[model samples]
Target: MKQPLLTTDFLDRAVDLFADDVGIVAEDGTEYTYGEVGDRVNRLSNALRERGVEKGDRVALLSKNSHYFIETLYATTQLGALFVPLNFRLQPEEYDYLVGDSDPDVFITDAEHAGTVTHLQDEGGVDEWICYDADDAEAGQWDDYEAVLEAASPDQPERPDISEDDDATILYTSGTTGDPKGVVHTHRTQHYHAMVHAHHVEFEDDDVLLWTSPMFHINGWGHIYGLTGIGGKHVIVRDFDPQTVFERIVEHDVSFLGGAPTVLNFLLEHNEEHDVETTGANPVRVETAASPPPKRTIRRTEDELGWRIIHAYGATETGPLITTSNSPRRIQDGDKYDIVNKPGFATINTEVRVVDEDGNDVPCDDETKGEVIARGNQILDRYWNKPEATEEAFTDRVEGWFHTGDIATMDANKMLTIVDRKKDVIISGGENISSIEVQDVLYDHPDVRLAAVIGVPHEKWGETPKALVVPHDGADLTEEEIIEFTRDRLAHYKCPTSVEFREDLPQTSTGKIQKFELREDYWNDDEDRRVN
Candidate 1:
């Protein structure tokens, strides 16, 4: 008599109970009711089925924030196919490995990024190519998305009988030292995570969500499922301009939006400059994650904008919403900013622990910094096609628990305050830039002999990657040249903001570089730890 937990259940309930309600607002301000959204999903699913997408097949999407992201997610998962959403900011070359690794049969993208993967489609990795606004697309032989949907039958697709444990999505996360690894989540994992996250944020049917966060980022922090299931409205924002965000919040009466601390900083700047209205008919609450914001940022966002801030912590491997600072009872006990500033205890039915190098629990005096570990239904099932990497992740510090590689301190109340990154991954502006990845790129420079990358404090972004290099003898490598080299090869955001010339990099006798020592100059002191 038990019902299976499925990701499609969210959309199914929306169409069944809230068909007449507006479910999504497109990037261009067009509204789509749940009925229309369901019709489009059915058409897309049928079209993909006709074109050879089947159970266990992968359907990849490359786009920014849009209604089509939600459509594609349900369409693919409903048919027992795996949904793969790529980071749209990635370069053409950067996608080569992701495409090769995922090996999707169908690839979809927006007109802006259609041409980026033209060569990938031609190489036979993908069987079908569909692009939104195909008339303006630069890629050849791509079919229009609307045309494909119109040609297919607008009926419920014949779904293959699937189980909860079946793989549902593949999200790629940056590996500190090598190629990006795919984090795979099953239907039950996403479904349960959405439910737990919905309760933590206290989502209601009448709530309105502004899609400020990119939909590709952990499925917009899993709001695409939680908000939709609760019969809330989604207002899309394709390009996150500060002015546009404030306007949308005022116009749509947006009750909730996910903005990292860096994004909140931008909004604070714009609000101060223009003196714009921050909210509409509804009180606004923003969910911030990625890297923890500085105390100054939290104070300004609350004092100036007058919006409630819910800070969270987790990686793409975790549910990305496993921990949140949104305790109503605790707010009455202490100052509001002090309570919401740190990532509070784990969500309902989730277990989080801070463990020492020996896998023992650290004293929760808010002083002992240890690696964060978690276990929950929301965690990723496995890393796609990388069994060794998956095993290492779960067994590195504690056996059977997912080692998060994030260094944090827990309070007496089990609240977690992140201090640094153990793996050297730089979380700048809500995007994970692998310090090793940048170092690898720097090593390719002919003038560079020894290279290291570390996150340094930034006024705008939470922090940014900075490169330190020891040039070869008599090789005059300027800072501009080092920065320009990475810009040409990597995404501009992933490039180093500044470079430093050094005579030698501190290394152990075993030739391993000590980045923590190099980070001391950029970071203030022991009290001011690196908030990766």
Candidate 2:
């Protein structure tokens, strides 16, 4: 690790470093230089300050991937306010829970989500909100963000005296126990993650980054700073559509992008009429972690899309980028297919170990699987407002180690393959489904005596949640009614797609539901690494 350079004003320094370079390009063709971005961000910061946004204040942002989202995040940082990015995909009630918990000062949103934000505001107690496209009639009551920026000063404020330990961002992560927990990170920690990513992923100054993933996701795998740290250009996408992604990739000559397995799956399956030129070495390189990419998806990207797909793993609490499956260079000679299939070694700044239940390290023999744990500079500072959870997170007999709760194995050469989430595994589309979350929704059901949800293979949406229910004594419950009940009570993805009536469920001596035993039959023939 190199000696630390600048402590704060990372965006300002990056702006000067890449002044002449294109900093951002919108889908509608608006472009701005790095210098311009810095100026606007500074002005926006001053404007926010005038509007009562103070140091350490939480400012929420609910918008798609666009220049405005970037502007608000950088600007909020300037004022020393924590940027709380809201997932647009989350249900309105979920957002309500988050807002009530975090109590952000102002929510910077776009016209598309104005109605949702308005609804939240009416439920009231929220501080304030500003909309990026308020001039549109659909925006209704929110103040104009553009108007605010125009009235504010472009001069950068004196960098506030912030310690390395001061919170910079509050990223929310869904927990199996409750709504979601805010994973807090400091400036130093986020900088460290970006530094690690830049060195390991090799994001260059000239590279153009296409915003395929939502910015709400761990700051889009830390590309917010990782790419900016190296002076990379950003090409914004308002929403992720297959044709839109391909068009932006070619139109901007995108060299880098990140997404989940679902994003890649959509791109591969898209049979649109656009003439895509994917021959020769692909300009696009993708990093995926939302879910592990299937071997077929990996091969298609490499063979047809000309992409260099890298599988990286991390959680919102880990500053996101922890491990990357760097495609082996030797694959070009022979068995290119096999080399790309392996999830590569631990990341540059991460020290990973596969450990048994007894907390001893497992062998690097590939076949012996254990829980994966990591210690890194990018670990979250704590779970906000929850001291017990924070204490528990940092707790372990091993000093400074954070338990990831993922089961994996390492090869002789240190390549890792993730097997399962310790508690949940679902089998759908011939894929293992980890119901770390479905259990939460099931437990909330009123009539359910005992509910254990698993995944049965599905032709689409990969894995579908299937619940095995033990109803109250002599109670007759139909699968359709249960499915309908869950559909109204939980997120569509979390709802059970199928139901199995059972008199009893398999349980351990200590009374833990044995999900492994329950999933064995559904995943018996699957070749994918996760099912095992």
lDDT of each: 0.86, 0.73
lDDT of 2 by residue, 427-529 (tens): 5555444463455455445455566777666678666788988776556789998888878866676678889988887642212355656777686676342
Which residue runs of candidate 2 sit more than 4 Å off their true CA positions? 1-9, 137-140, 271-275, 279-282, 327-335, 396-399, 426-532
Which regions in candidate 1 have their CA more than 4 angstroms from the true location? Answer: 424-532
Question: Candidate 2, 179: how far from true, in Å?
Answer: 1.9
> Per-residue CA lDDT of candidate 1, range 465-520, in tens?
99989886679889999999999989999999999999887653212356767877
Task: List clashing residue pairs in candidate 2.
Answer: 325-344, 425-433, 426-432, 426-433, 428-457, 429-458
Let me know the TM-score candidate 1 reaches against the reference structure: 0.82
lDDT assessment of candidate 2: 0.73
Per-prediction TM-score to the true structure, in the order listed: 0.82, 0.78
RMSD of each: 10.7, 10.9
Model 2, backbone clash pairs (residues 3+ apart or across chains), number: 6
lDDT of 1 at 180: 85
